[model samples]
Target chain A: MFEYIVSKYNYWVYIFLMMLGLYGMIGKKNLVKKLIGMNIFQVAIILFYISIGSKVGASIPILTAEDLHGSANPLHYMNPLPHVLMLTAIVVGIATTGVALGIIIMVYNRYKTLAEDEILEIRKKSGV
Target chain B: MKVFALLTVIITGVMLVYGAEDFPKWGDPNQPGSVHVAPRYTQGTYIEAGTPNIVTSVVADYRGYDTMGETTVIFTAGMACILMLRKKKRGEGESNV
Candidate 1:
């Protein structure tokens, strides 16, 4: 029982974080808060991927002299693919957040408010 | 509406948690992720790219095209933000009155 829990505990933590972020994204009224939630969700996913790529006794993915002299064993080196992929994902997330914030600013300027409900009401009144 | 959103999120989370049970343990070396083409990338990175960092090798060597596309996406997004958010100056188009 203990072994099972210990083995999968990381997943449980990520799940909780994912849920919290999901709730914030869906239930929050403010656009900035929703953007924050999206950031949290992306971060949780990145952490989960990174954790999966880690090994118990592996070092960094950089190849050292010892690796060249001996057998090129994968067991000693952590997986590098996930890290590379997540690096791109993080950059994409930052770009997305910046665009999203800009759009939000435009929305606020046009509607004179930031709340979703208020924006909707204004749109309805204006037949937009 | 908030309650409905909460319910949906809870259900999605439960489903995701249940599905995660089938994933390989934290660091099983022989898992499919490590077994497939990843081994080639890890093994050949040094010879193929001469880069000490395997991540850098894979990103810049093996997946160069994808990285280029991603860079383009970032540029496009920046341009979009500027186009949408930049306001016109006060006297730019006012007929000089």
Candidate 2:
């Protein structure tokens, strides 16, 4: 069990980070805090995917001169698919954060508050 | 409410950890992910895409359409932010609506 846990400790660390982000998103009242939590969650996921592509003794996903002429050995390089997929994911995450912040700004402008509970109270009072 | 949030987080974490147990050990070359198309891409990237950097070729050449879509998504996001936050011009129609 110790060896099993030790071998996969990276997953454990990422899970912990994800849980922390989840807690921040769920427990915080402020909109910006939730946004921050969401960003953290995204970063954790990206890191997890990047880690999935790693090899014990592999170089980066670039071919050397010998590798270029001969058939490139997959084991000699880290997996590149995860890194490529995560590149798109990172772009999407940035877009999400940008739009979310814009919406939060609009919400604050109309409600005059950033707290979720206070905004709810104002909405109830105003019948909106 | 915070207690409820913590409980939810703990439950989610436990489930994820349980699922993660099935994942291959770190840096195992024979793992399912590495055994599949990764080898093909690694072998053919130079001949097919003429790029020594496999990642750059995969993103820009192999998955060009996906990258294009990603660019569109970012453009949409920028437009949304501008539309949402831009101030009204002076003497424009009623600002309340």
Candidate 3:
């Protein structure tokens, strides 16, 4: 059990972070807190992918001069796919956060509150 | 409601832990993620693109189309934000809600 835990501890840490973000998204009543949780969740996922691409003694995904001339060993460098995918993911996360913040601002302007429950209550009272 | 949320989080955590049991050890070179296409990229990046940085070459060369689409998505998102949040001039179809 200890060996298994030690071997896969990175996954466990990311899972724990994901759960924390999930809890914040689900339990928090404030709209901004929910956004923060969503950002955290995205970051955790990105970290998980980056961790998967790592190798024990590998350098970054840059080819050294020696590697370029000789047969490059895959094990000598980290996987590039996950890093590429995560770059896209990071951009999408930023775009999502920007749009969500914009919507939240619009909500605040109209309803004058950032709490989910209060916004719902205002909607109920207004019959909208 | 908070209790329900906590329960959901715990259940999700448990499920994730269970699923992660079969994952390869950290920094294991032979992990599935490092096999297949990754090896090709690692070995052939310099030959194919003359770029030393495999990640950069993949993103900007091999996957150029994907990055272009990603840029389009971001542009669309920025336009949506501007459309949704920009201030309106008075008496320009403004109404009290």
> What C-alpha lDDT values do all the predictions have?
0.85, 0.89, 0.91
Assess each model's interface with DockQ, reporting 2 decimals per model: 0.52, 0.74, 0.77
Pairs that collide in candidate 1 are: none
The whole-model C-alpha lDDT of candidate 2 against the native structure comes to 0.89
On lDDT, the leading prediction is: 3
Task: Indicate the residue-level lDDT of B74 in model 2.
Answer: 93
Q: Candidate 3 has what TM-score? A: 0.96
Compose the digit string of candidate 2's lDDT tens values, residues B1-97.
9999999999999999999989888888888888889988888888989989999999999999999999999999999988888887888744432
Steric overlap count per candidate: 0, 0, 0
Estimate the overall C-alpha local distance difference test score of candidate 1: 0.85
Runs off by more than 4 Å, candidate 2: B90-97
* Chain A TM per candidate, in order of listing: 0.93, 0.95, 0.97
Error of 3 at A71 (Å): 1.4
Docking class of 3: medium
Rank by lDDT (best first):
3, 2, 1
* lDDT measured at residue A7 in model 1 versus the true structure, 0 to 100: 89
Q: Which run of 10 residues does model 2 chain A get worst, by summed lDDT?
A: A65-74
